[model samples]
Target: MSGVGKSTVLRELGLRGLEVVDTDDPGWIEVVDGEPLWRLPRVTSLLDRPRDRPVVVQGTVANQGALYHRFDAVVLLTAPRAVVLQRIRSRTTNSYGKAPAELARIEQDLRDVEPLLRAGATHVVDTSAPLPEVVLAVERIARGA
Candidate 1:
């Protein structure tokens, strides 16, 4: 999912005046027991407060599932394996999938993890579409459309 256009789309949404949070940003995630997880208190407090508009947050991690009930929509952004790997290789925003091991891990996740995410998703959008279409679809989801 790293290359499925989450950050780019989130930036576009922010430009359009939507509230967006990329939990991959620092201070949002912490490693515990060798796994990266969202900082519970911070995210919980964030969702606890009322807001004029929906806050669309992008993240892919094991522990996030526990908070799904608090969200209005659980969306999974997906792309084909080749597209995902290619985007990962070229992306400048993050260096996650550059290494051989990381790419392999991502490939594994694609096979093992993504399906579970799909099953739980209220909506699933394929990012192989044009960027505008992907962005629009996600924006609509964020807006509760």
Candidate 2:
């Protein structure tokens, strides 16, 4: 997760006033102003409000239907299986007593999301690029800048 540029891009955008949400933050599951609420009702309710504002949510693609309709665009970051495995190995802090199995699960998750992306929820930005390049690409998309 650290090797991926999700947090990087989201932070950059947030610094520019975009309301950024990273589901990896435990607080995301709690109700709080300006923080992400993972529950469908809360997220949808926030989306329904009228505002001349921007929001960037970087979350694992698991249980995605909860926020699917809430977003105007979805940027699914894709990386090769081996690349992701390497990333996990280098970055995950706790192995949960089964590193190999956890790596397998991550690979499976990437495979599963490929279809949703193919079906076209929105844009899919490949994070395999260099960090700056990836950030620039996401910025351009975020602002149409």
Candidate 3:
């Protein structure tokens, strides 16, 4: 989930004049033992912001039950294991799943956590597609298509 292009899609949306927030932004993330954790209150505060357009908040923190009802729509972005691994290797912003232990944890999440998130998602998009296409899909979902 860390490398599923959530941030990239949010950036594309921002360029197209949409309001967006990536929860992984500085001050909203806390690293614990080299693994990133969401600063829940900060994230909730950001989500509470008023916006004229649909504000897209992207992250893998959707599993937090308390935050579920706050979202009008939940879009889960998924990719195959190979693609996820590749993206993780290429990413430079955060060192997620880089170490052996983290990689194992990420693998476990792929098998366990992702499906639970998927079950609760209002919409699901495959990130193996082109970035623009993925952004378009997210936009459509955000607009309640």
Candidate 4:
């Protein structure tokens, strides 16, 4: 799930002139004792903008209870397990799934958290498609198409 192309899609949306907010932005994450804690208030403040156009907020933190309901549409990005592992391993910006213990945690998240999010998703996009296709699909969803 960590490597499901959420960041790529968010970037593409921003390039296409969409207002994008990435909850994983530095200030939103407070690493306490090596564990990253999402600042819900900061995230909520970011989400509390005027809704003239859809604001695409990309992050795994949307699964936290009622926050999922605040969005007009919730798009869940998914990829095959192998693809996810490969992407995580290849990523240079973040060291999330690199260590053995982190990889185990990521695997467990795939098994545990993903299913619940999938069940609640308004739209589920498979990110194994070409980047353009994935971006197009997400754009359509964000536009309520």
Candidate 5:
């Protein structure tokens, strides 16, 4: 999940003129009862608006299942565990996965959280593919091609 190409693909999509929302932003998440959930009102308002182009949203949180139905497609990007760890360790774009504690959490999420996401997902992409190919696949999905 962490090392999957969500951010990378998202950037490419944006450059290609797709509307993209990265929900990892603070405004999109709210903490309630010590659990993180998407701020439903904000998300709903965004999704409700009429749009000329497809909007691709990217994020993962404990309560994302609650908002799955609001999306055109729920896509899960995944890579092998070792690949994820390696990327996490070396990635320069984000510093999240470098810490040992965060790494542990990622390992645990891979086991516990990913399966749930997979089950809820309408589509799954193995991000081990070449980066351009991965970007093209996601672009096709966003373009409804």
Candidate 6:
């Protein structure tokens, strides 16, 4: 999610009239409704009693099979390792993880998450191109527009 621009694409879709659910924000935590909740257990309760809405959920977290099963589709974004490293470098100047080890750890996380992408994700977006291109790809995948 950090390197992938999932939220950016989702926001673009929202602008085009697609209702979206961004679980990356903490506020989503307050809205859980049902059983077999989202990967975040609290979200399960939210699902049990969901509000009247058409939404696409997006986030990166461990153990999300529950949400994965519930969603009509899942989008996983990935970019070339060098591009991702550059993105992290350019965008995270003010972050606490500015040191070499921290950056290395972030790259490691990306590598470690690769298997999960292969195993669980339904659609994978290769985000090595421009943002608009990535958003366009996701829009096609999610909105078919």
- Candidate 1: stretches off by over 4 Å: none
Error of 6 at 10 (Å): 2.4
Task: Report the lDDT tens digits of candidate 2 across residue range 9-50.
Answer: 788777767777777676446544754346655556657777
Report the poorest 10 consecutive residues by lDDT, candidate 1: 1-10
Score candidate 2 by TM-score against the native.
Answer: 0.72
Model 5: weakest 10-residue lDDT segment is 63-72
- Tens digits of per-residue lDDT, candidate 1, 73-136, equal 9999999999998899888878998889988889999999999999989999999999999989
- On a 0 to 1 TM-score scale, where does candidate 5 land against the true structure? 0.95
lDDT of model 6 at position 44? 66
Off by over 4 Å in 5: none
Model 3 C-alpha lDDT versus the unseen true structure: 0.82
The residue-by-residue lDDT of candidate 5 on 41-88, one tens digit each, is: 898899999999999999898878888888878999999898888888
**Model 4 CA deviation exceeding 4 Å by range:** 30-38
Which residue pairs clash within candidate 2? Answer: none
Give the C-alpha miss distance for residue 135 in model 3, angstroms: 0.5
Report the Cα lDDT for candidate 1: 0.90
Show the colliding residue pairs in model 4.
Answer: none
Candidate RMSDs in order? 1.0, 5.3, 2.8, 2.3, 1.0, 5.2
In order, candidate lDDTs are 0.90, 0.64, 0.82, 0.85, 0.89, 0.67
Clash tally for model 5: 0
Q: TM-scores for all candidates?
A: 0.95, 0.72, 0.82, 0.86, 0.95, 0.74
Q: Which tens-of-lDDT digit does each residue in 1-145 have in candidate 4? A: 6989888889999999888988777787776677666677877887886667778987765435558767778888999999999999999988889999999988998999899889888889999999999999999888888
Local lDDT at 48 for model 1: 94
Best by lDDT: 1
